[model samples]
Target chain A: MDTCIEKIRTICADLLAKGKVQKVIGFAEGSIPMASRPIAVTSKEDVAKLVFNATCGLNLANYVSDVLPKEGKIAVTAKGCDSRNLVTHMVENQVSRDQLYIIGVPCTGMVDKRKIAALFEDEITDFIEDGDTLTIVSPQKKEKVSKKDVLRHNCRVCTHRNPVVFDVMAAEPVEEQSLDQPFADVDHIAAMDPAARWAHFQELTKNCIRCYACRNACPLCYCPTCFVDESSPQWVGKGQDKTDINTFHFLRAFHCAGRCTDCGACVEACPMGINVRDFTRKLNKDALELFGWEAGLDMEKRPPLDVYSPDDPNDFIK
Target chain B: MNFITIDKKDWTTGIDKSRETYQVFGPVQDENGCQIKPLAPDVHPLMDAGVTVMSPKSVLFPQTQKMLTATLDASIEDHHVMKPVKKDDTPRVVLGIRPYDARAILLVKLNFDNPDYQDPYWCEAYAATTFVGLGVNHPGPCDFSTSTGCGPFSEEGLDVLMADLDDRYLAKILTEKGETWAGACGFDTRADAAESQSLFDILRKEAEKNITSVDTDQLSEKSILDLYEAPFWDDVAFSCINCGTCTFVCPTCWCFDIQDETKHKTAVRFRNWDTCMSPLFTHHASGHNPRGSKVQRVRQRFMHKLKYFVDKYDQGIMCVGCGRCVASCPVNIDIREVCTIMNNYESK
Candidate 1:
C-alpha cells in the first residue's frame, strides 16, 4: 500500500512537470476519516493528497467529461470496470480518445458505503487496509471484515479484469472474471407466469416517483432532445397516472434493451430502491440471445438496434 | 411514387424476403400488449397495427451510455483518459410504424440534425434505419395524432409507405431507399405521379377530418409564452407527483444530466436522460433549483413543448398528440382537456 502511494505521487509530479497533462483528477484523502472523495490535482504540490485503498470505491470516470481540459491533454486513472465505461464512452463518441491518458489498475473490488455504514452504527473515525481485509475504527467500536463481504453488485460480475482500452498499464492485468450466472435473477423472474410477472412489475413500477434517476445514471442516454418534451402534438400527457407510470418504465426499459451495459448504476442511483436491474438484465439477455450482441464489451461493434443486415429475419411482423 | 398490390398471403412472404437484406425492427408482444422488437422469423406477426406501449425513440437515443473514463491516482502513470465512441451506420428497416410515429421520426430528424443543433447518436441510428411505415387501418383508443395533422402515412422520413386500401395494401415507394427496397421485393409496377398525388390528398383529407375540434390558433407560441404565470398551472399540476412520467412517456422530451462513477483508481463519466417534472431536474450543485416546485416543473414541460421548442425550431410543434399521457396518467390529466382549458381561458 505504501509503495502504491509513493508510485502515485512520483508519477503525478513527473506528468505535471513534463506538461503531458494540464490537470489530474483523482481521489484525495477526505477531511473525514475513511471517506475518499474526488479531487483535482493541478500541481505537484497536491500529489501528496492522493490515496488508493479499500474504501476508494466511487467510480471517478463520472467526473472526467466535465473537468478534463479540452485544449491540452488530461490524465486519469481507472480500474477494470471503470475502463469498460471509458470504452463505452469511446464507442458512443462522448469524449475523444486522443485527449486522454489512461492508467489502468487491476481491482480486487471495493466496499459498498451503505453496507459499511449499516455494519458500523457509529461514525468511523479512521480506517486501515491490510491486504483484502478492512479494519474500521469508529468512536465506539473497531470492526474487521473481508472486502469481498461488502463488494458492490457491479464488482461481483465484473468481466474486464484488465482495461479493455488503455494507454499505460499500472498493475498486472488480471484475468477476466466469469459471469455465467449473470442472468440468474432475470431468469427467475421470467419463469413466473404472466399474471405473476405483471403483478411484480406493477408493484415495482407503482413505487416509481418518476425521478428518472435511473435514466440520469445511465451512460447511453445522451440525447440532446428527448421525446417526452415534444408539445406540437403532445404524444404523452403530463400527469402522474398509473398508465403514465407504466409508459415511463416500459419505454425506458425498451430503450435501454440493447444499449444497457448492466453496470447497476441505475439501480444504485435509485432513491426508492426499485428493482430497475431486472428490466435491464432481461433486455441484456434478449439482446445477447436474439441479436448476439453485448454492450460495453467491444468498442468496434455497433449497437444491435442501430444497424441491420439485409438477411435479417422478420418472421414476427406478419 | 410507386405502388404495388400483393395478396395477403404473398404480402408476408414478400416482406419477409425483403427484410432479409436489411436489419428489421418492428412491434412485438411481450407480457405487455406491444413493444418494438427486433424483426425475426418467429416474431413477424407482431407487426399488426396497434399502439405500442412504448415509443421507438429508443432505436436512436439509448437510456444509458459511458461518456468518458478516468483514473484518480496521479502516480499510476497514465491518469485522465477520454475515449469517444462512433455510431454505426448500417442500413436497416423499421416495419409496421404508424403514420404518426413515422412523422415523429421525421420531427426527430429535423430537431436532432438541424445545423444549429446536431445529435450524432440519433443521427447515426436514423441514418442506418430505413422506415417502412404501415398505415393504421384502425386508430386505437389513445391515438390522437390524426387530429394534429399526423396521419396514416407521411413522406417526411419514410423509405417505403404501405397503406391498407380495403382488401389490398398499396405500397408506395417514397425515397431512393424505398425504391431500392421495392426493387428487392420483385414487384416492378411503379407508382405513377398521379397515384402519388391522389394518395397524398386522400391522406390529408382523412387526417384533417379525424382531427379533434380544438382551437389551436388561440394557443400559439405567443399565447403559451404569456401563460407561463397563469393560475392554470397550479390547478393542472395539483395531481402531478413530480415523478417525471410525462417527460419519460412523451415522444419529445429531451433534457439530460451528467454524472461520474469512480472506484479505487478508476472513474467513469456518463450522461443520462432527465425530465423537467422532477424537483431536481434543474437543480444545480450549488443547491439552487430553477424549476423547484411542481407548478414550475409542469409549466416547463408544457412551455418547452408548446412555446420554447416552436420558438427555437421555427413553428415546430413538438407534440404529435399520441395521447399516451392521457391513457397512462394515474390522475387522468388529459393533455387535450388541458389544451381545451387553455384555449377557453385565453378566449375569455
Candidate 2:
C-alpha cells in the first residue's frame, strides 16, 4: 500500500511539474480515522497529499466532470469502480477523452466505516492494511481482523477488481473473483410478496430525513436541476410523507435504470444509513435480465436505455 | 427548584404513566443506527441508546412540514384562498435527550422564536413539548460542547436534566413544567437540592475534561469579511461534495425552503429542510446565483454558524457542538479544525 501511495504521488508530481495536467485530483489523509478525503493538487509540491488505500471508497469520477479543465488536462486517481464511472462519463459526453489523465489503481476492497465504527468500543486511533488482514489500534488495545470481515457489502460482491481503462497503472492488476449469484440480494427482495416488499421498503426508508446525500454522491446524478427541485411540474413533493419519500427514492433510482455502475457511493454517502443501493440494484437486475446489458463495461457500447432496439422488451409500454 | 430521584425498578412504570398523557419520543436502535424516534404503543425508549445517528431537532422542526393548505377548485366561493394549517399542540415529552442536543434546540429557538418573526409551527411545537435531558457520563470523541458554551450536563434548554446513578437516576427538575410532568409520572421522591447540585457539578466537570478540542473564543472578535475571503475556504470546499448529510444530521441547521403542491382540488404548502450546500438553495428566479461557486456556498455554511449568527444574535454561535456533522460527514471535513483555523487567523 505504501509503495502504491508513493507511485501515485510520483506520477502526480511528474504530471504537474511537466505541465501535463493543470491539477491532479486524488485522495489525501482524512481528518478522521479510516477515512480519506478527495484533494485537488495543482503543484508538484502539493502532490504528496495524494494517498492510496483500502479506505478510499468514494468514486473519484464524481469529481471528474466538475473539476476537468476546459483546456488543460487533469489527472485523476481512479479505482476499478471509478474507472467504470469515468467510462460512463465519456460515453455520456460529460467529459472529453483528451482532457483526462487516468491513473488507475487496482482495488482489493474498501472497509465499511459505519460497520467498523459499530465493532470498536473506543475510537480507532490507527489502522494498517497488510495483505488480507487489517490491524486496528484503539485506546484500549490493538486487534487484527480479516479484511473480508470489514469489506463493504458492494465490494464483497464486486466482479471488477481491475480498472476497465487507464492511461497509467499505479500497481499490478488484481484477480477478479467470480460470484455464484450477483443479484442474490435483489432476488431475495423480488421473491417477497408485494405487500411484504412494500412493508420492507417502508421500514428501510422510514428513517430517511430526505437529505439527498445519495443523489449528490453518485457520479451519474449530475442533472442541473433535479426533478425534485423542479417547481413548474414538481415530479415529487418535497416532504417526509411516506408517498413523497417513496416516490423520491423510486424515481431517483429509475432515472439511473441502465446507467448505474453499482459503485455503492449512494449507500456509502447516506447519513441515515439507508441501503438505497437495493433500489438501484433491482434496476441493474432488470437491465441485465431484460436487455442483456451492464453499464460502464465498455465506452463503445451505449447504455441499454440510451439506445433503442426493435427487439427491446416493450411488455410494459402498453 | 427541587430534585427528584427516580428508582431504576419503577422507570418503566413512570414512563408508561407519562405515555398516557404525553406523546413520548426517545432514542431507539433501528437497522440503520440509533435514532430518536416517536415511541410506538408497544415500544419504549431505549434509555441507554448512545448518541443517535440523527439529532432530535426533527421532533419540533420536522424535516418536512405543512404550513398551510388551500382549495384549488374554481367553482367554490372561497376558492384559491390560503388557510393556515391547524397544527396539533398536544403535550409531548422527549425522554433521554442528550444535554448538548437540548441546548441545540435552544440555539434553534433563537431563530424560530425570535421577536422579529416567529415561526408558528416551530414555536407551537416547542411550547407543547417538555425536554427531559440525559447527561452524558462519557462524551463521544467528536463532542466538544464545553468549549462552545455548553456541556454534556448543561441545563440551558432542558426542563429536567437526569444523571445516571448506577441503579437510579437523579432528576434535577429545573422548571415548573418539569415538575408537573414528573409529578404525573409519579417521579416525586424529593432529594436535597444542594447535594444534587454538587453531584451534577462533579459529573459535569468529569465529562467536560474528556472533550479537549478547538476553541472559538477569538472567532467572535474576528472580522467576518476577512475570514470569508481567507484562502483556506478553497481547500475546505475541495473535498465537499455539496451533499446535505452534514446539514441534515446537524441539530442547529434550521434552514428551510417552502413550496406549494396542488392536487386536482386541494393545494398544500410544505416547508422542507434545506441546506446552503445545494446550488439551488441560492439560485434566483432569473437563474442568477450570487453564491453559485462551491467555495462561496461552503464558506457561507461555516461563516453563518461561526460568525454571522454570533454577530446577529449576540449569542455565542449557531452551534451547540453536538458533533453530528463531524461524525457523519462523508469526507470527514471536520468543523473543529475549521474553527481552529478561523479562530487563530491573523488576517494574513
Candidate 3:
C-alpha cells in the first residue's frame, strides 16, 4: 500500500511540476476509518494527500466529466472499473481520449466497512491494512482478520482486477478471479415468481429517501437534469410513495442499461445501504447474455442500448 | 426535575406499559443497521445504538407528510378546495433519542413553529410527542457536538434526559410531559437528586473529553460577502456530487418542498424533505436556476449551515455536529474541514 501510494504521488507531482496535466485526480485518506475520498491535486504539495487502499471503492471515473480540463489534460487514477468507465466517457463524448491522462492502478478488492464494523460491539477507532491482514481496533478489542473476509460483495465477485488502459501502471496487476456464477445474486431474484420478485424489489426500495446519491455517484448518470428532478414534466413523484420510488429506481436502472460496469459506486454512495445494483446488475447480466457484450471495454464500440439494430432481441418486448 | 431508577428487569415491562397509551419509537436493530423506527410489540430499543444515521426529526417531521387533501369533483360540496388532512394527534414517545437529536428537533421547530407563520402539520406533531433523550457515555470519533452548540449530554430540547448506568438507566424528568410518561410506565422509584446530579456532571465531563472541538469565533465577525466570496469554496465543492445524502441524513436540515399529487378525482398535498444540494432547490419558473452549478449548490449547503443560519438566528451554526453527514458522505466531504475553513477565513 505504501509503495503504491509513493509511486502514485511521485507521478502526480511530476505531472503537475512539468505542466503535463493541469490536475491529477486521485484518492486521499478520508476522515473516517477504512475510507478514502476522491481528490484533485494541482500542486506537488497537494500530492502528499494521495493514498490508495482497498477502501477506494467509489469510482474516480464519475469525477472526469466534472473536472475535465479545457486545455492540456486531467490525470485521473483509474482502477479496473474506473478505467472502463473512462473508456465509456471517451466513447460517449463526455471527454475526448486526448483530453485525459489515465493513471491506472491495479486494484485489490475494496473492503466493506459495514461488514468490519458489525464484528465489533463498540465503534471501530482505527483500521490498518498491511499485506493481506486487516487490523480492526475498537474500544472492545483489537483483532487482525484476513482481508478476504471483509471484501465488499461486488469486489468479491469482480473479474477485472487490472486496468485495461493506462498511461502509467502504479503497480503489477493482481490476479483476477473467475467465478462460475457471476450473476448468482440476480439469478436468485430471477428464480422467484413474478409476484415474489415484485415484492422483493418493493421491499428493497421501501427505505429509499430519494437522496439520488446512487444516481449522482454513477459515472453513467450525467444528465443535466435527472428525470426525478424534472418538475416541468415531472416523470416521477418527489415524495416517498412506493410507486414513485419504484418508478425512479426502475427508470434510472433502464437508463444505465448496457453501460453499467458493475462498478459498485452506487452501492458505496448510498446512505441507506440500498443494493441498487439489484436493479442495474440485472440489466448488466441481460446485456452480457443477449448482446454478448460488456460495457466500457472498448472506446470505438457503442453500447447495445445506445444504438438500435434490426436484429435486436424482440422476445422480451413481446 | 426528578431522577428515577429504571431497574433492568423492569425496563421491558415499563416500555410495554407505556406503549398502551403512546406509540414507542426508538433505535431498533434492522437488517442494515440501527434506525429509530416504531418499535413492534416484540421489539426493544437498542440502548446504545450510537448516533442513528437517520435522525429522530422524522418522529415529528415525517419524510413525506400529507399536509392537505382535496377532490376535483365539481358537484360535491366543499370540493376542489384544499382542506387540512385529519391529523392522528396520538401521543408518541421518542425513546432513547440522543441529546443532540433532541436539540435538533428544537432547531427544526424554529423554522416550522415561528411567530410569523406556524406549519400546522409539523407543529401539531411536535405538540403531541414526548422527547426522552439518552446521554452518551462513549462519544464517537466523528462527533463534534461539544463545539457545535450541543454535547453528548446536552438537554436543550428534551422532556427527560436519561443516563446509561450499565446495569440500568437513571432518568431525569424535566417537564410535566415527561412526568406523565414516566407515571404511565410505573417508573416511580426515585433517586436522591444531588447524587444523580454529580453522576451526570462526571459523565458529561468524561464524554466531552473524548470529543474534538471547532473554532467559529471569526465567523461572527466576518461579513457574509467575505465568506461567500472566499476562494476556498471551489476546492471544497470540487468532489461534491450534488447528492442529497448529506442533507437528508442531517438532523438539523429542515428544508422541505410541498407538492400536490392527484389520482382520479382526489388530490393530496405532501411535503417531502428537500436539500440545498439539488439544482431545482433554487430553480426559477422561467428555467433560470440561480444555483445551477454543482459548486453553487454545494456552497449553498455550507453557507446556510455555517453562516446564514448563525446571522439569522443569532444562534450557533445550524449543525449540531452529530456527524451523520461526515460518516455517510460517499466522497468524504468532511463538515469539520469546511466549518474550520469558513470559521477562520481571512477573506481577500
Query: How much DockQ does model 1 earn?
Result: 0.03
Candidate 3 global lDDT: 0.89
lDDT of 2 by residue, B40-99 (tens): 978888887667888999999988889888898889989889899999899999999998
Query: Worst ten-residue run, lDDT, model 2 chain A?
Result: A116-125
CAPRI quality level assigned to candidate 2 from its DockQ score: medium
lDDT of 3 at B104: 88
Best by DockQ: 3
In angstroms, give how far residue B173 of model 3 lies from its true place.
1.0
TM-score for each predicted model, relative to the true structure: 0.52, 0.95, 0.98
Better of 1 and 3 by TM-score: 3
**For model 2, what is the error of residue B103's alpha carbon versus the real structure, in angstroms, after optimal superposition?**
1.5
Across B1-348, the per-residue lDDT of candidate 1 in tens digits comes to 467654565666766777667777888755323567567765574555356655676666554455567778898667876555544667777777767777777666676788788877777777778777776554544556754556655555577777766565667777887777766656565556677568756865664554454444455535654578676776566434344556655666656666555669878766666777656567576867787666787778777766666667664467777765654442345677666665566523
Question: What are the chain B TM-scores of all models?
Answer: 0.86, 0.98, 0.98
**Which residue runs of candidate 1 sit more than 4 Å off their true CA positions?**
A1-318, B67-79, B185-210, B221-225, B262-268
Best by TM-score: 3
Candidate 2, residue A212: how far the Cα is off, in Å: 1.1
lDDT score, candidate 1, position B62: 53
